[model samples]
Target: MNIRPMEYVNRERINRSKQLIFLEPEQKIQDISMRSGFEHPSYFCTVFKRLEGMTPEQFKKSHGFGI
Candidate 1:
């Protein structure tokens, strides 16, 4: 792959998190981060916002999965 190893991991982590976002709409970001293989929720949110253009909370709300 052309991407760096960390980049690949980050993308995979984000992808996994996205699935959880839809599957567990009511789940908290911290829990979602943990379930998605992230060691820290804050880092997960940071990457999520960077890639998706919105925080996980925002993404969830935007998709009608959260309040």
Candidate 2:
């Protein structure tokens, strides 16, 4: 099976996403999107929510950040 470029996982992107999630729990998705190299905040939110099965706020709250 051939994997498409978009479907392939980039470890660096994953790491950046993790850092954005952990280091800036209180920051808005727009700011996180920029810092994480995502040009579109909405697209970022979509991708993030898809990968994690929830919004950023929900993820933070579930991880004990308390919203």
Candidate 3:
């Protein structure tokens, strides 16, 4: 499986986002998004929803985060 550089970066970003969500679930979604290298919170939410099948807030809540 040959992965392009951009694809690898994107994958890493998404993985990082997931880890951050678990690590700091109480943090604001926008903060997490930006920390994960997403330029805009909305874009992050869109991509996250598309890839994870739920919004970041939903994911957090599902994981037992109060947010």
Candidate 4:
């Protein structure tokens, strides 16, 4: 299957978000979202939930981060 441009961008954002979650657990969600190239934290959370099935905070908690 061919991937669309937005799909690639979304995937990259998710990957970067995951990296930030692991590498910088202490970082704020807004900062992580910005670093992942999201213009707004709310939008980032929406996309992340759609892709990952859980919010970033939940993902972090699952990975043993205090959030």
Identify the leading candidate in terms of TM-score.
4
Clashes of 2: 0
lDDT of 2: 0.70
lDDT per residue for candidate 1 within 1-67, as digits (tens), equals 8989998899899999999889888888899999988899999989888888999988888888854
lDDT of 3 by residue, 1-67 (tens): 4978876776678789999989988789999999999999998888788778999899888988988
- lDDT over C-alpha atoms for residue 38 of model 4: 95
Q: Relative to the true structure, how large is the alpha-carbon lDDT of every model? A: 0.89, 0.70, 0.87, 0.94
In model 4, the runs with Cα more than 4 Å from the true position are none
Error of 4 at 6 (Å): 0.9
Cα-based lDDT at residue 12, candidate 3: 76
Residue 52, model 3: lDDT of 84
- Among all windows of 10 consecutive residues in model 4, the one with the lowest summed lDDT is 1-10
TM-score for each model: 0.92, 0.70, 0.84, 0.94
**CA RMSD of all predictions:** 1.0, 2.6, 1.6, 0.9
> Top lDDT: which candidate number?
4
Off by over 4 Å in 3: 1-7
Give per-residue lDDT, candidate 4, residue 64: 98
Which window of 10 residues has the lowest lDDT sum in candidate 1? 58-67
For residues 1-67, could you state the per-residue lDDT of candidate 2 as single tens digits? Answer: 3866664443345458768778877777678777877788787777777776887677778877755
Candidate 1 Cα errors over 4 Å, as ranges: none
For model 2, what is the alpha-carbon lDDT of residue 66?
56
Error in Å for residue 27 of model 3: 0.7
